[model samples]
Target: MEGLFQRELDPRWARTANNASHWATGVLAGAQYGLVAGSVARPRIGYGVPLGAGLWGTGYAVLPAAGLYRPITSYDRATLAKDLGAHLLYGLTTAAAFAALGPARCRARKAG
Candidate 1:
């Protein structure tokens, strides 16, 4: 078990793991937006819905790339509550849009 765990922990695997997860998450997110937009059952939700999805998807994809992107305004209880709520709201909107359309470029690195 020790050897098995060590093999799993190899740094080379990290690159592969992150890249695959990133792209898979991206595509699924786009599909999510497509589903949501379709659920409206309205013919009028054409460009805006899809466009918004793309914006959201891109935001999601790029967010991780930029590093810890969560913005916490303050640690005070009152301020923290407000910040948390706002961040959650922003996160949901960002996720919805990304799941709708964003797909970041991903390429697995060859072993060296």
Candidate 2:
């Protein structure tokens, strides 16, 4: 994924810089996703869909407007669709993993 993103960036940017940016984005995104998941009274795997969608929407729509990235309109349809699908999947899987872990922790605490 970092490689893919690097390819999209300006060629003048060093590989190290692109890698750093990719890592930072991933860390920040994970933190944000975790916060969204934790905010719910009972985090469910299904919640990830909306969470992911929200993030995707913000990234595509807001990021460009804020000068963080190129505008969504500038991307070809295929790229846009690919990004949207990827984000939704990311959200679903992340939420599902969190939901799965949550029950076990609760059960362990109760047993203890």
Candidate 3:
């Protein structure tokens, strides 16, 4: 349909989708952290695990800002490499975060 085509071709729609996805991901990550905090008897471990998760999530959410305001410089193969490297770093950081969180809710609850 014409309406569908307009929506699909719009850059604004993609940006909105990206922002919404980021917000949802952050909230879910925060909830996972809270669940981890709730499950552990020791408030320290409970807090630490979630804190780590949250720190990483927050870092992930803000990291896009770094690439957003890049300086206008000469373009070269090196520039391309650096951009790719940054993206790769982002992916690795995201993996490390989820791995570190590692299903904090999966273990059986400890009896009080």
Candidate 4:
């Protein structure tokens, strides 16, 4: 925001906005996965890696176009590998957690 205009930013608000954006992105991704996995008879943990890799690759393509990041080619292989590794972990953990929770119908049946 400061870059767009000459005005200074309030650090507290900046942090809050940053945190909110991070959370919103995570929530959106989780909801999307839930919708997808809910339709499956068995949701596999392995499915999440492709989701994560897709998100990472999409960011590389979209962020650069939006001017948030440089082209993927500008980064070294090691750096890209490390970033992709983190994203893969995110995907795996998301899938694992979703699987552990099971479906809402299962939980309802168990409760009854």
Candidate 5:
């Protein structure tokens, strides 16, 4: 914000906004995964790796245009790898938690 908007956020507000956005992103991502997983005959935990990598790639694709990040090429391998690793971990955790709930099923009532 300071770099792009030329305005500084209050420390408290920054923390609050950061936390809120993180949680919101996680929830939204989880919802999308749940919907997709629930539709499949058997949702494998491994699918999360691709989901997470796709999300990471998406951020690289979009954030640069938004001025929030440099182009992917600008980052060194280590940096990219670290970020990717974090995303992968998040994806795995999400998949594991969902799997723990047992097989997915549609809870909708049948139309009479």
Candidate 6:
């Protein structure tokens, strides 16, 4: 994962620090996704799928422009498929966790 990210970065920034930064970025991204998922009313698999897919689509458009990652078109089919699969999995897992936590439902339950 680090190697892949490093490849897209400028030579000066392509070092251990950048790899660590990438890992940190991933962690932060996961947290943001969790927060979004948790805020949903009923957090189900259906909800997660679209949320994750939307995020992936948005990242493809934004990340390259931001210089964080390469454009989706630059990657080969296998890499693109792998990334899509990973994003889907991340979304599904986040939704499952959110459903289990049931933040919105719990709030409603308590209020009622």
Error of 2 at 24 (Å): 3.0
Shift of residue 33 alpha carbon in model 4, Å: 0.6
Clash pairs for candidate 2: none
Off-target runs (Cα >4 Å) in candidate 6 are 1-40, 103-112
How much lDDT does each candidate structure score?
Answer: 0.46, 0.73, 0.48, 0.78, 0.77, 0.71
Candidate 2 ranges with C-alpha deviation above 4 Å: 1-10, 14-22, 39-41
For candidate 5, write residues 1-112 as lDDT tens digits. 3524555656677677657766887799999998888777667789889888978898789756765557899999999999999999989888887776545333333232
Tens digit per residue, CA lDDT, model 2, 19-76: 6764676568767877766666577988888867877888777656545467777899
Per-candidate clashes, comma-separated = 8, 0, 0, 0, 0, 0
C-alpha RMSD for every candidate: 14.6, 5.5, 11.0, 3.9, 4.0, 5.4
Indicate the worst ten consecutive residues by lDDT in candidate 6: 1-10
Candidate achieving higher lDDT, 2 or 6: 2
Predicted structure with the largest TM-score when compared to the true one: 4
Tens-digit lDDT string for candidate 4 (1-112): 3422345556777777556755787688888998888777778899889978987898789756755457899999999999899878888888888887777667787799
lDDT (10s digit) by residue, model 1, range 66-93? 5422323323568645644543454455
Cα lDDT of candidate 2 equals 0.73
Alpha-carbon RMSD, candidate 1: 14.6
Please give the lDDT score at residue 53 for candidate 3: 47
Q: How far is candidate 3 from the true structure (C-alpha RMSD, Å)?
A: 11.0
C-alpha lDDT of residue 6 in model 4:
48
For all predicted structures, in order, the TM-scores are 0.32, 0.70, 0.34, 0.76, 0.73, 0.63
What's the lDDT of the predicted structure labeled candidate 3? Answer: 0.48
